[model samples]
Target: MSQIIDTSSRAHLLDLFLGLRPDTLSLWGKMEPQQMVEHLIDQVQYTNGKKIPFLEFSEEEAKLAKQKNIYTDLKIPKNVIFGTLPDQLIYPDLPSAIKQLMTELDDFDLYFRNPETTAIHGAFGPMNYKEWIIWHSKHFTHHLSQFGLIAMT
Candidate 1:
């Protein structure tokens, strides 16, 4: 069995977030600070409760995912657009978002220790808890890196 995400790594996540100065993020895209924050928050919410609409990939998208090995260790390329709602999409406040993400991440860590908890990923189909953890870690890190928040130094 694989080790789960360390929920106690709040300091690491916080450090990453704090390292993100506004100007560095602005270089990524047109998103405002609040919008980027909301985007991260929405990801946590979607994982915790709502089943985001999963679309059958276009041939192009599927080919790209396969070529890029999205299901494996490859990094999601920068500016390789997929589908997500605009950051203007309404969600809970920033504090609430952070709290929710923390709670869910903790819950996921616990779930990883149990054998029965299964997660249905949007693109990757069914996944065990360990797989889900890797997916979330990579996905979140991708976004954080995109925002110039964290570098794998």
Candidate 2:
């Protein structure tokens, strides 16, 4: 079974982000390094208090989708467009954007400590803390691979 490198390995993960250069190239997709980092930060906010109301599937469909996503080894498909974020560059640079992403990740952990709290995902419907973490790991792995920082085997 192929396993994702979990985001809990924060130090190593941060190293990959820190290594991104201004001229880094993506294997696919149009997002620049800083833009991608900001994009990830926006997505991570979905687990905290961000209220995204879109759902890609019905309750039963989302349930099945969630099962396949979280319990199985499905990698998040690549080359997806995000309509939520504008063409704006939110952070001054890649390192700063990555730093902000880590802050949001820390907030995600704290936000879900109540356990009773859940957040909506446009595709997966609602998920608790642990589910979000797994999803985030997969999400991060996908983007990291896009930059050739890691390979999926």
**TM-score for every candidate vs. truth?**
0.65, 0.89
Q: Which candidate gets the maximum TM-score versus the true structure?
A: 2
Q: Output the worst ten-in-a-row residue range by lDDT, candidate 1.
A: 1-10
Residue-level lDDT tens digits of model 1 in 1-153: 122223247777765655554455454556654556566565554454444535356655644554444356676556665665473546455455455556666655665566875654555555566555566666667667666665632
Number of clashes found in candidate 1: 0
Cα lDDT tens digits, model 2, 31-149, are 77887898888888877675455777898899888999988888878888757546689888777888998888888878888979888887788888788878888988888888888
Candidate 2's C-alpha runs over 4 A off are: 1-3, 50-56, 82-85
Model 2 / residue 4 / CA error / Å: 1.4
> How many residue pairs clash in each candidate at the backbone level?
0, 0
List per-prediction Cα lDDT, in the order shown. 0.56, 0.82
